[model samples]
Target: MSATTPLEPAASWYAASANAAPERPPLSGEVSCDVCVVGAGFTGISAALHLAEQGLKVMVLEAACVGYGASGRNGGQIVNSYSRDMDVIEARFGARTAQALGDMAFEGNRIIRDRIADYAIDCDLRDGNLFAACNARQLKGLKEHQALWERYGNTSLELLEGDAYQREVSAEGYTGALVDHSGGHLHPLNLVLGEAAAFESLGGVIFEHSPLVSLEHGSPVVLRTAAGAIRAERVVMAGNAYLHGVLPELEGKSMPCGTQIIATEPLADDVARGLLPNGMAVEDCNYLLDYYRLTRDNRLLFGGGVNYGGEDPADIEALIRPKLLKVFPQLASVRIDYAWSGTFLMTLNRLPQFGVLNDNVYYAQGYSGHGVTCSHLAGRLISEVMRGREGRFDAFANLPHLPFPGGRLLRVPLSAVGAWYYQTRDRLGL
Candidate 1:
């Protein structure tokens, strides 16, 4: 591919408001490095930055521009914990195993803040995120959710019921909300763009528009692109949903799912303040949930709905508008400034996948819908393995990853059926 790859996120709100960036030159000839990181999204960039700061010659190969994938187009909420809650991990994986994971669950959020401040990145960051419940059942679940995280040592959690919740969010139909004071939200694309810049400042090189066409994961792993190749002592696969054919083993192990988001025009100051009084990002408690927050400019940015098999819906606005209105009916007359969709990897168990491949190649993926923070955690863990440490990385790497029961052809349909059932229960408050 050429150095001028067409970025798919051109239509996203983040793209329009992202910080100024320079077009990086793609590799056109053979190059070698101590570490070759594939995909310059959060995982790849984080890993490359960590290794480079350690005095390693790290080179990152990105198929598109940095943050082109889920890193750029996610809901942007810095929600801690994985897609599966800590209680779920405790129930199935045991308290000892869950305790290990729970200890690190909030570490990724810290990494993000450290990157922003240490790198002098100007991404608009706000603290606190809310888990809102639409019904009594979900509300009760939130109460238990708070207790579970508290047991895991998350001291920043507080549950608000009825009138207490109104001080934070004036949205309708919510019985209560669980607030995570430590959790937050930010301009995701700008965050990645700033982090990518930090990586480069540490003497790291990132080749934009350079896709890893093939991989020979041996002693000195060889990564081939259309115009050049890389020979490295080790390789890191951070592509996630965008890896495509590069890692065939992940075919049935995970699936890419598309999510829709829309940004509304700036609202009046009073209305903006009235909508989300405390400026905390909110996500409903449902199998398929609606997440929304006010952008720095006071525009309500709402996102919801997942299309299995990574299919973009025919109308992004049509699919998300109704959900947005349900939360804030006062925005009925607001104009949608931007609407877009992006894909993220979803594993069968909704937990991230981290392990070695081909001996010299390490991969961390399948963040499900929670890649914003977990991806950074994966990067740090992968870097530890390269620095003569494996204790923390082994915690996640040792967990079993189950492939979708059906073959690739049937996985999507089967997963869709499962989602439908759960969403149905969500609708009925079961």
Candidate 2:
């Protein structure tokens, strides 16, 4: 459970469809850089790309291959906000802070679009994301959510109910949906690979299979890996859930959770179109929400269910296929093409945890399940902070984080108990 432990990427649909990327050599000997980043996932690569663009000498160290973690294996939905919604932020941090955070909520989506266009990333980018409601209560929640987002100047949201919902998606159970035109989906692994290429093109250096074993912080912090070491004027830790035991300070604030996904064999084009008429990524409004979308090759990718302690299920397909069938029984006879699970960090309040260990060491993690866009935004904010522009970064850094209630040994059980409450409510249609 340490970041330094060598791990291979899961045999996921994303891996099978990933773009061919050159193997980056592992780090050897000693190297010096203006900034050294740990964990070559979205946040690390993004920070490296932005910093390299600013002419800063940057080196990224990855415990495994690029995008080997959740960055590559996620649902690929460009969800445009924090795991904890803005209303929660407004209530907890006040309207002023909520306003600031709300403005930046969709910034990550914008960053992804800009990166795709500027670098010509071939990630099968699509437009539109839908939040489906499974019951009357959930539909009411979506309506309130829409109004909350509108108060923050997001007018791209549209409500779909009854026949309109059926028109958008052929799924039988959903009562309504909230469509966000600004959100979308794509090939996650390919997108990360393309971004890494863009980063390297900007003079950034990356070392794969090189995990940080120890750190010596000072004016020039030193990071030691198994075979090599790096001395950087500044350092950024972007490992999130997989950081493992590398940083003790972060371990207690966030707990790692696992989510599983399965892809069906390529369906007929007509069937795929029927499943999602508008071709939008969809997630339901449930505690352990179900999310699904169609791959470019016409396979259905459905994911849900979580393990609070980050344990992969024995049979991922068996664990999730029933959930898929509940939403679309027609897929019962279809063969599953692939199944995999990925871990994401969840904070006590379900918001991202951002702060500095010292003046020279900055870290961001705990995006829960919403890291796709938030991690990219974290990269931009990290780069800005490094450049002495702290306004935007401080908005998030200022948000307080509480450690899990029961420490490591009890945290998982305690979380499971709390989750049961919400899951029961979801099941009862409350």
lDDT of each: 0.89, 0.91
The parts of candidate 1 lying over 4 Å away from their true place are 1-6
* lDDT of model 1 at position 310: 87
In the range 1-430, model 2's lDDT, one tens digit per residue, is 2445548789999999888899899899999999999988899888899899899999999888899888999999999889988899999989988989999988899899999999999999999999999889999999999998888777899999775888778978788999999899999999999999999998899999887888888979999988889999999998888897777978998898999999999999999998898799999999999999999999999999789989888999999999999989988899998999999999999989888887999999999999999999999999999888999999999988888998989999999998899999998998
- What lDDT is obtained when candidate 1 is compared to the true structure? 0.89
Q: List the residue pairs that clash in candidate 1.
A: none
RMSD of 2: 1.0
Give each prediction's root-mean-square deviation over alpha carbons.
1.7, 1.0
Over 1-430, each residue of candidate 1 has an lDDT whose tens digit, in order, gives: 1233345554988999999999999789998999999988899999998898889999999988899988999999999989998789889889877988999989999999999999999989999999998889999999898888888778999899986888899866788999999999999999999999998888889998887778886879989988999999999999888887777887779998999999999988999999898899999998888999989999899999789888788899999999998888888999999999989999988999999987678999999999999999999999999887998888898888888888788888898898899999988888
Q: After superposition, how far is residue 59 of candidate 1 from its true place, in Å?
A: 0.3
Pick the lDDT winner: 2
CA lDDT of 135 in candidate 2?
Answer: 89
